[model samples]
Target: MLAKSIDRLPPPRAGGWRYEPKFDGYRALATIQTDSSVQVHSRRGTPLDDAFPELVGALYAYLPAGTVVDGEIVCWAGGRLDFNRLQRRYAQRRHARELAVTQPVHLVVFDVLETAQDGDLRRRPLRERRAVLERLFRRIPARSPLTLAMQTSDPAVAEEWFDTMAVAGVEGLVIKPANSPYVCGARVWLKYKSRQTTDAVVGGVTGSLHRPAALLLGRYGSDTGRLHYAGRTTHLSDAQAAAVAPLLVAAIGGHPWPVRLTVN
Candidate 1:
């Protein structure tokens, strides 16, 4: 299941909704066969066992056979989820074993897709599925790499988590209806991410004077004191583009970005 990005979190109603931390890591699905063999798949359906051997071993050792789980694979570094470290493991296969021992990845399980006895749980309500997931976690031995993602129904509590838990590598919060069934490939779930605005210097522009394109942005580094490329904004309206054209004359001397602006 996937979540649709929303500008804001919906207000809590009498009917109920579940909120959970959105982890910043690779979205992975783990399937444990009846013979205790484990296979992990990435969001794009690529095999992940080769890059995440530790996770495969832990799932095979702890979770019972015929278990299918939906979760995120995250690497913790300096008390936060380090995506760069995880990407390094994925790209550099030769040193994966050493990195697995030193950095150790964790599978933050959020949903149970299937169980050994009950079979597929996607049709079950989220409340019921969560209960089963919690019970499954309780059966795991101590110090296992598998972790159950925290959840709550209170929007206030969810906001507090969003505000405070970002330091712990929480990307945002996922909101789902309590009684809704898990709809695969459906945008039933909503995601809320904290956002803030910052000022960036306009380095260049695309398009012509009559119709302006995006604004190439830059920012001055505090240590380097140099204008570094930040990013580009979306296309501008014709009127807005014409209004800003007079202000964006080409620099006579050396500019921060010397390359030509290519519009796409």
Candidate 2:
């Protein structure tokens, strides 16, 4: 099945519809045509065939040639999705063997991009796509490498998963408009980042020597007027970070360094 692209932020359907927890992981696009040839692409439209051989093999075995799927590639470790580990395997030289031993890849399929003999379904409603998805999932084997993305209409359940992930050191939660059509290259999907609350001193800012952007974060210090290397927060504007940095430096005067706290 060849998946077609759609706008991400389409209006919701009237009957209301299904809802699924968005995973904080790599957005993967899998395409397997009738000839059994398989292609995997990242959200950025980059090819990822060489990085994950086991995943490719799994897709080849379970999905019919020309089956196209839209999903997230995730690696779960110690009750959390280990994105760092997933990234590591992508760069490993012996990824196949290493992935088998270390962090294994799993496809959390959520949408059916293409359906057999039906022609392009990109512009169709999500319910239509989901019908194809449900049918396609019934045939494929459910195992580690290939599995359906968990779905729940209950806000409580979704909230629980979000809390569990946050406590477990996972990235964050993704919330998608259930009946909304798939949109390519748009922020139609909403992402809620896991905020790590910490107090730190304002650092310095610098203009982008090469680009138009500016930096807005710096290290932390103690009341004793000591300088400590705290993490940077680029969340502020260049003007904001630059404005407060000087005052912060002078307010503390000259003091000795204190203990530091490092977050994962």
Candidate 3:
């Protein structure tokens, strides 16, 4: 089935709901059919089979057959989420293998879409789906590789987490509708970053850094019809070098987004 995403968590109605703390990482869907084989997908609808190899091992070990889940793939660094480390794994094979041995990997599963052939619950309310998810996760031993995402019904608690996580160098908060179903490709998942940032068009890039290369990300200006290099990230670990770098390069057309920004 085609999976969609929601922009924000919906408000509670007459019925109650379950709210989960959104993890700061890649939004992925994990599928485990009857044979216990697994597949992980990215939000943009790309297969993440090559990106996270270790997770494949974990999924094979923990997930059961005929079950599919929606969740985040996160790497904890210094007690909080680290995008740099997360990006590093995608950089090179050597780094990925090295980090796998050092840091390891974990999954924070939040939703269950299909439990069995009959349990295609994408259309169910978020609250009800979460009920099934919670019970199922509870049955799985905590010492196992998978972990349930932290959640709270209280807005205050959610806010508190947002505050603490921000101070801890985390990315942002993801608020989901407690009663909402898995709306693939939609905006049901609301992502609140520390700063309101957009994926701008990158006109040019800088030279290589510790690993392979650095990048210049930018956007098109409405009135000027020009591309401007807005930001640079030297901390783009190894993973970004291999995956995101090529994509950013390919996105360049004759003039880039605005057709004005140049390499200086």
Clash count list over all predictions: 0, 10, 22
State the C-alpha lDDT per candidate. Answer: 0.87, 0.65, 0.68
lDDT of 2 by residue, 143-228 (tens): 64888866655556766776676766555555555566766665655555556676555343333322223333334444756545
Better of 2 and 3 by TM-score: 2
Candidate whose TM-score is highest: 1
Sort by TM-score, top down from the best: 1, 2, 3
Runs of candidate 3 with Cα error greater than 4 angstroms are 1-18, 94-98, 195-264
In lDDT terms, how accurate is model 2?
0.65
RMSD of each: 4.2, 5.9, 10.7
The residue pairs in collision within model 2 are 1-66, 1-67, 3-113, 7-183, 8-183, 32-66, 33-65, 33-66, 225-255, 226-255
lDDT of 3 by residue, 1-264 (tens): 232344444466554444455566777888886877788888777877576777777777766678888878887877877876776765654566566768666678877888874479989987787778887776667765578877777767766776677755655566666667787667655655554456876455555333346676677778997765677656566677767644553342365444344543
lDDT of 1 by residue, 1-264 (tens): 889999888976656999999988999999999989999999789999988788898999888999999999998899998998988888976777787888788999999989987889999999999999998899786688899999999889998999998888788999999988888789889999876579998787777533568788889999989898888888787777878777786666788666775444
Residue 4 CA error for candidate 1 (Å)?
1.0
TM-scores of the models, in the order given: 0.84, 0.73, 0.65
Instruction: Please identify which of the two predictions, 1 or 3, would achieve the higher TM-score against the true structure.
Output: 1
Displacement of the residue 213 alpha carbon in candidate 2, Å: 7.0
